[model samples]
Target: MKLIGLVRSIRALGEVAEQGSFSAAAGVLGLTQSAVSQHIAALERETGLRLVDRGTRPMALTEAGHVLVRHGRTINARLEAAEQELAEIAGHRAGRLRFGSFPTALTTFVPAALGRLRTEHPTIVLTVVDDHMQGLVPRLTDGGLDLAVVYDHEALPAATTGPLRRVHLFDDPYRVILPARHRLARRRTALSLADLADEDWVGGHSGSAWFRIVRHACRAAGFDPRIQLSSDDYRAVQAFVAAGLGVALIPGLGLVSPTAGVEVRRLRAGAPVRRISVAHLDDEGQPPGVRAMIAILVDVTSHLRRAEPRRS
Candidate 1:
């Protein structure tokens, strides 16, 4: 039998053994149930031995099936290790890269990095999962994500650091937004929180990540911001600020487009900066694609940090 076909047949056999039914195995393999049945039938014809006890409720692997499955799993593991070794030498020549990231990054540096990765490794398949950092980390830990773009804040609870390696990328500082015609809009210097003590706040959702950061900073500055409207979308927040609804604090990543009537400025000091990182399984034997993705992330974020964005 051809090595590739033999591997697929063996993989299907093992999946059937673990799942207890051809239908379940088909679901896992993204194939029709009849395809799994055909693979098992072909294996039986090739081996001249019946491998399944189909009369049983969930089906059972026969003695021959069990033995083949045990050996097949070992073979599959070795093949995977060999593939990883070859990938390191060849640099993501063939394999799927499962990656994840938060929404803003998805729209920002992450997409550019993905474009470069596709250019460098055209044959590499990509699976992207876009979500919040809290949702993405667990997926990484549970083997769902091979690589992810995650962020950490010194003021916030640290990222979960077990069994995963985080490659530090860049710091995303929170910047202040003001109405274009507001008094502080003309100031070249970073604004102090006290500079807006009397202004209403157009902030993030009441209890969301950015909201908490803004609230904490305002408290540190000796006044609680009076939130007039809570909006998490940076564009909408900028629009609100432009209309003089209130001043707002937005992360640098979200400032890529500030709309027409809002001015962007830095916090003089004590601004919350989120550190971006590329995370992957640390147990080693990482796929070349994962490492390649990390390098791309670094390159993309570095450009983001250095580019002088045109003010809107």
Candidate 2:
């Protein structure tokens, strides 16, 4: 029998028990009294039990009728809930996307991209994680992350044999960050890498991707960086720059947007620019939503690239 048919019979039994009259139950169910009696009779024959106590003065349910009414209501409630969840999944109205990013990218670049995606696709849930390359690479390879924004220097760390693929988003040039009040900032112009050799430097952890990139840039420019303070936190470097503690070379991606309290100047001899890419497992065929997300990333990256002024 149709599930709705069973539900309707349970409703009839409940109303008959509550009102103690077939005519009253029919009025509540929007059916004629004869139709209500026929439905009750059909249910009684199907169950091989007399649901209504015909001997009673008004009409009332037998114990079997009461039991059917209770179970039917519970079944109807579960079916309704299941339908709602199925609809949500079908429409992509609710689901989660696990996203990961390196700390430096997460601070500025990732937020902008995610904000744009969220505003457009509010139903696509995102679980954002911030870790260095060492931590995130393993997770992405193990199928723990659906998407990742990874930072890659010239000499990136070794990769595990996980089925992941990458798309180049942008190559952001490194720049020199000096306090606004510093003499270099007064120039209001880009400075050569050699000009920055004598300054104190604030940096990230010794072995971090950013640390290696910055150190390499200084060495290529012909001097070792005089590191004054170092921490794993990228924001710490920004804070130190804002505090005039030292001058540091920062990746162009790190300056994706204007940050207060620090003066960002491009380097004449050029600093190391890291290649940031979006990666996902190759074997796990991306869902429609994930494909849509990749399209959004490509669109935003193109917009950012076009907005950049002619450097030559």
Candidate 3:
């Protein structure tokens, strides 16, 4: 078989393995089902082995099929990397980047960095996905995103066991949000986590990462927080605090605009900080657009760090 035909057949086999059916793979590859069947059939003829078990429902890849598909995926990834490098070498600014970020970062420095990127690379297309670390990490690993802005709290560290290359962005310190008229709001000294042990806590949904972080911080201070209210929205959590519902711990990025009737205060000790970073696949070299965006993010965060309010 010709090299081009062999590559196409391998790609078709990989897609079939992923999509689980010839028709599905056909749709994904923008080819007719008959054409997809011919490609696989050609591969089977060239390999002298049955690559797929047609007797199974949703299709099943034979042992030979699995081996070829695995190698095919690696080949595809390398080809993609080569294409990106060649584009940069040829001075092609026109490309698309799939970027992901958590909600707070999306609302904070991400937009500024994206705007700067657009100004500098006018021909580059941008697609942004807003998701939590749980969603973003998997996407990065599976090549669903080119880059992501992710964070992990000090109380509960992020998983670091993957093929992810991360660049430290900045630390977003967690602060106590209190009702303006609450007694703790009047304290001249910074309050410890233990000081709010008895207060009703407004927190993230039960069993969520943020909720776990809050529980871990409180337990470290020798108390189990009595979380009476829950919300995933940082703004809503601030609202609950302002209404005197309960005190909550919110990160600095989430407090870009503190709700009215709320007081933001620093922790005297053991403040939980969210360490933000830009992450990408380790095997893929940073394309020009990705590198440019990362640099812009660092610049934007530097200005934010300087302008952050000093709450004590």
Taking the tens digit of each residue's C-alpha lDDT, what string does model 1 give over 1-312? 788888899889989988989999999999999999999998999999999999996888999999888777656755665675587577765677889998888988888899999999887788999887667877776566788988766444445433468898877878888999999999998888889889999998875667877888888888899999998777788889999899988888898877898899987666766777888767567776887898888877786556533322
lDDT string, candidate 2, 1-312, tens digits: 566787787778888988898999999889999988888988988899988897886877889988887676556544543554566668845755778888666776567778887988887767888877877877776556767877576655566223468887777787888888888888866799899889999987787777888888788889989999997655677788889899887776666664578988877655577766788777444654567667777777885566554443
Residue pairs whose backbone atoms clash in candidate 1: none
TM-score versus the correct structure, for each prediction: 0.67, 0.62, 0.76
Off by over 4 Å in 1: 1-93, 158-163, 304-312
**TM-score, prediction 3:** 0.76
RMSD of 3: 4.4
For lDDT, candidate 1 versus 2, the one ahead is 1
**CA RMSD per model (angstroms):** 9.0, 17.4, 4.4
Q: Which lDDT value does model 2 have at 212?
A: 81
Model 1, residue 159: what's the lDDT?
50
- For 1-312, candidate 3 gives per-residue lDDT tens digits of 987788899999999998999999999999999999999999999999999999888899999999998777666655675776687678884676889999999997888899899999887778899987778887777666888998766455455224588887887878999999999899878889989988999999976768877888888889988999999999999999999999999988899899999999989887776678898888646676788888888887886567544443
lDDT order of candidates, top first: 3, 1, 2
Question: How many clashing pairs does model 1 include?
Answer: 0
- Give the Å error, residue 82, model 1: 11
